[model samples]
Structure formats: C-alpha cells, structure tokens
Target: MPTYQCFDDLQLFFKENNIHPNIRFENMNENSIFSMVKHNLGISIIPEMIIPKGLESIKVIPLELEQTRTIGLAIRTPISPAVKKFTEIAENWCRFDKNIV
Candidate 1:
C-alpha cells in the first residue's frame, strides 16, 4: 500500500491477523495510496475521502474497527454576512445526513 507514514494500527492488525505481505513505505504526501494500488504495486487501507473516480477495479474491504475523523469549519473574523449564511446552510445540510456529524 502507498502509505505516507508507518501506521501502527495497520501493523497491529497485521500482527493480530497473521498477514504478511511485501511492504514498501513511501513518502505519504507524494501521492495517494489509491494511485499505487491502481499501478498494481500493492493494496492499502485508506480513508474513503481519498478514493478516486472509477473505483470498480479496486476492492474496498471494510475494517472491523470503528475508524472516524472529525472535521470543522473555520471562519476568519469580519466574515461577510453572505458567507456566514452559507456556512450555516452548509452545516445544516451536513446535519441532514444522519450518518455524518
């Protein structure tokens, strides 16, 4: 998998599951791991946000652990009224989806 850094969680999963594969850790920022998987180098566990278009070739195997990340909106002071309204609308739109925070 094209990983930016050594993932301890992944290592632990491998140890617990007895999975040993040829591993090559590259600079994480160089490219997304999905790109490496597309090149047929190896497989990886990645967040869903980075998955590219046309994902039919890639098989996404779900992990048992509850992996979650928090996201927030940042606004500079003296924000325009329209911008503030848009932010509130966006937050409501996101909240409409019960699965998303």
Candidate 2:
C-alpha cells in the first residue's frame, strides 16, 4: 500500500488481522503503485476510477468487505455552484454506502 495517511489505519488493521504480504512495498505514491501493477512488478487493490490510461489488460477483482474510510470534502467558503452540487451528491452517496466516508 502507498505510504499515505489514509493507509495508516489500514496497516494497523492488517497487522491486527495477521494479513501480511510476502513482499510489501510501502512509501510509494499512487502513480508508482499503478505503474508497478501495470508492469507486473506487483499487485495492488485500487479503485477503478483511478486506473491510469493504457492498462486495460489488467484484471479487476472486486472485494466485498466491511471496511469504512473517514472521508471529507474540503471546500473554501463561498463554494461554487458545481462544488456544492458535487458535495451534496458525494455526501448522499457516502450516507448510502456503509464502507465509504
């Protein structure tokens, strides 16, 4: 997993669950992770929306789990119309899905 702040909790969860990979690659960015997966350097669990261009051949497997991520929508005061619409949609979707936000 990437060495992102979001992965901190995930790492702890993995340790508690005794889920360890043979060769783990941490301290990498999302782009590097995607490149590694594309070139068969390693495998990653990424969202479909973030997949880079020209990696259509890669296989996709959706895992169903009861995991939740605390998400936030940061917007400055006096938000634009578009941002307000997006925020509303996002919050509604987050409320609907238990594993997100």
Candidate 3:
C-alpha cells in the first residue's frame, strides 16, 4: 500500500493496519510540502486541487474510495429579486459546467 501524509480515513486505516509512515506535521498550504514530496523528502497526502504541474517525476495514483465535499451558497435575510436572479444564473452556470440539468 502506498503511503500518504494527510487523508483522515487513510490515517485511521494505517493505525488499524499497524503501519506507520514517516509523517511530517505539515499542512498543504505550505509550498514546502509539495517541494518535499517532489524531492522525495517524503510522500504526502494532498488534495487534487493543489497538485503541481509537470510532475512526471511524481505519480498520482487514484484510490478506489469515493470522497466528496459539499459546497453551499448563503445570503443575508430578505433576498432581493436581483439576488434571486443572480443565484439562479449561478446555479445554471454550475449545472452547465457539470453538464447537468
């Protein structure tokens, strides 16, 4: 099994499996984390959004597990008609991007 630095479920799995990786206590926002991984300083678990470009040296193997995050829209009370229209437009935009109705 490949190692990871920051997946919550994967960390639990590691504990269950009694396999400990060289976990560095670093957050993903720091560029050093990517640098370290690229330099083979250590392997890390990063979100897909932050993966760097031209990383042929690094391999991004996909996992079988399915994961998703929920996104929400919020507005202040007494939403105006314009705001409602804008919200509809935004939803349409997102639906178009996803090719969904």
Candidate 4:
C-alpha cells in the first residue's frame, strides 16, 4: 500500500496479527494504489470514497471491525440557514458512507 499514516498503522496491525502480504507497492497518491488494483497490477486496502464508481469492482468485501473512525460536523452558533442545510447534507453523506462499509 502507498505510504501514509494509515499504512503505518496497518503495518502495526499486520505485525500484531502475524499476517503479511508478499508483494506491496508504495506511492503518495491513493489513486496510484487504486490503479494498481484496478488494472490487475496489485491488490490494495483503501477507504470506499476513493472508488471511481459504485459496485463496479470484480469483488467487494466489507469489514465489520471493533473500531471505526468517528466523523463530525461543527458550526458556529449563529450559522446561516444555507450552512445548516449543507451540514445536514454532509452529515447524511457521512452516515451513508459508514453504512456502505
């Protein structure tokens, strides 16, 4: 997987779990990793939002883990209606994102 803080964390996970992948690739752009998987270059582990299309991959697997990242939206108290609406939409998108995985 391309190097990132998350990859460091994943390395720790693999070490702790005693799992290893024989072949790996590293790059700054996540799309590079995705492209590897998409073009039969390699397999990758990544978040769902990076996917270019829905239900288009050869296989899709979901993981139910003991932990998940928490997401939130914050606004100053006297926010305009438009901002509030935007936050609502964003919050809903967050929920949808979580459910898909």
Show the lowest summed lDDT stretch of 10 residues, model 3.
1-10
* TM-score of each prediction: 0.57, 0.59, 0.48, 0.63
Candidate 1, residue 4: the lDDT equals 44
lDDT of 2 by residue, 1-101 (tens): 66665467666667867888665777457888876776888777554445566767677676465444555678998999999999999989878966454
RMSD value for candidate 4: 3.4
lDDT of each: 0.69, 0.69, 0.63, 0.66
Question: Residue 87 of candidate 2: its Cα lDDT?
Answer: 93
**Which whole-number lDDT from 0 to 100 does residue 15 have in model 3?**
77
lDDT of 4 by residue, 1-101 (tens): 75864676667666867777774567779767766777888776665555567646535565444324445567898999999999988877776865533
Candidate 4 — worst ten consecutive residues by lDDT sum? Answer: 62-71
Span of ten consecutive residues with least summed lDDT in model 1: 1-10
After superposing candidate 2 on the true structure, give the runs of residues whose Cα lies further than 4 Å from its correct spot. 46-49, 52-55, 74-86, 92-101
Off-target runs (Cα >4 Å) in candidate 3 are 1-22, 77-101
TM-score of 4: 0.63
Better of 2 and 4 by lDDT: 2
Give the alpha carbon lDDT tens digit for every residue of 1-101 in model 1. 53543366566667877778677754465355666676887777766656666788778777776565566789998999998998999899778957567
